[model samples]
Target chain A: MKWIPIILIVGLLAPFSLNTHAEEKSSEWVKVKGMVCEVCAYGIRKSLMKEPEVQDVEVRIKEHKVKIVYKDPKKSLDRVKLAQILEDAGYALEGEKP
Target chain B: MLRLGFFILALLGTSQISVAHPVIFKGGIELQGETQKKDSAFSTTYTFSPYWAVAAQYYEMREPSMSPLGRTFEASTVQINHLLKRWWNEGSQGNIYLGAGAGVFAPQGLPSEFLARGEVNADWESTTLYVAARYIYLHPDFSEDVDFKKLRVGFAPYVLEQEGLNSWFILEWRQMNTEKAEVTPLLRFFFRSVLFELGSSLDGDFKFNFMIHY
Candidate 1:
């Protein structure tokens, strides 16, 4: 009766309302050293993928940069910590974050 | 000959190709094949962890005159390698590896003997230059211990400096124990993650090596 229209309106609006708090993470590029071959790149990709906060990681061979996409802003993706990760994985950190 | 063929078949099992590379990352599969005038060898390597890898190989010598095994024989081996150390110098990346392996060597109509394998490798590479050396020692119950030495110097005339195709010119020297050494001039090309090399030994033996990783 009178309430049917109101119920339809709420249903249509509910789907849009729940997504308001969803956040996106930005991609960051980190420079790395000792990436002379694909083996080095594979090592980087494998290690980075293991981080629960990492969404996607790409290795740029020529530039020696790794593009990382984090899970969210709540998770910390400190550049220094990233340097340590790569260093431990056999890649040397050559320059500051680019 | 039949035993050799069966041994190779057992090694291949279901695979079509075989492997070689100085470096193998953890959790990768490598297939390798090597052929000489009268002998052929096939091998596979699996890197199980960041510091460990396991390899299996089957080798057959077709010519008894060329083989030191006293007769034509076939051998199968399984070896393990570990990454001992890796260092970066300026912009050049280098690594050193050491590993040991043991297997069984069987001569036709003869008892199978235990075989031992040992390897040491080092390599350094930049965008345009690559240098590497490797030593392998194999001692079988049936023959004199064999020592293999290899050295390679390569230069990339065209340094793409990006994720594309890079080409290199390589000169390689290989010696086995006191036998005559063979010099090879080679061309190496890398596209993405796969590397391929083609060369001819000075004695006119064609050689090819290919590598890839997941």
Candidate 2:
């Protein structure tokens, strides 16, 4: 019976720990020009995903923007690399979200 | 009527190469093919830069000849495509390209002749609307020269999400040299890096085309 309370306390604290860890992850939304179709978005996503630092990518065609999630919060993709990727995908990076 | 059908089929077979943009993303590769009765064309392209690409294409057409029999014409060419201009709008993009090449053209059982080709292509597209035009010229040393022109307009019935399948209804107009124009209504579908088109001309001829990017 005494072990029941210990188990409950650990279970309650695990959710908090996971939440704190998730908070450490980082994401950035960048503006990209000339994304007129889904094919354009696909190309950008395919190229960005090949980078080890990229965890996920979301494209907004109407807004001409892309949200990039990083695997490590402290280590982000450099601006030069980001520009090169977009250039290879036939797009121009217009900088980060305002 | 049969002669016209054969001519249209031959034109449609070679038309697929002009349907998509010639230049793709840097280091990208594309494969495209189209087929109809007695005619077919295939091409492979490599994009070395954002504005330049090289492609090799093979086209075959079986058409009626003056000798009471049909003759097959085959052409193979290596072409370089250049993106001359591009425009980016708020929700649309436009591009113009020029291409030139030299190859061999031969009719079955005939000596091959040197062939030279040139093309001008332009297009503008947004999420909901699309428009394009192209002109192609072919000159062979031993055969009559040929001119081909095409125009296309399309519209999407609904907006497609990033991960969803995209569909469009397109109408195409084509003319070969001084021949009568042919109109075709096409259904286009694209998912990710692959695209396919199915259509039938008003003359009851069928067409199918597909493209893949890697």
**Best-matching candidate per TM-score:** 2
DockQ (C-alpha based) per candidate is 0.22, 0.37
- lDDT (Cα, 0-100) at B147 in candidate 1: 69
In candidate 2 chain B, what residue range of length 10 has the lowest lDDT sum?
B6-15
Q: Give the per-residue lDDT of model 1 (tens digit) for B119-157.
A: 888888886788888887778886667666889898888
Candidate 2 lDDT over B1-214, as tens digits, reads 4333433433433233466788888877777787765556677778898889887777676654321124667667778999898776557878899999887777678788898988899999988899999997778788777666889999999875556788999998977667667788999999887888999989877988887778
Model 1 off-target regions past 4 Å?
A: A1-25, A50-52, A71-73, A76-89, A95-98, B1-23
Instruction: Estimate the lDDT of model 1.
Output: 0.69
DockQ of 1: 0.22
Q: What lDDT tens digits, residue by residue, belong to model 2 across residues A1-98?
A: 99999999999999998876554548898888778777788788988998898999999886888999999986678777898888777777775221
| Residue A25 of model 2, lDDT score | 46
What residue runs in model 2 are displaced by over 4 Å at the alpha carbon?
A1-25, A95-98, B1-16, B65-71
Which 10-residue span in candidate 1 chain B carries the lowest summed lDDT?
Answer: B13-22
Model 1, residue B63: distance off in Å is 3.4
Clashing pairs in 2: none
lDDT of each: 0.69, 0.77
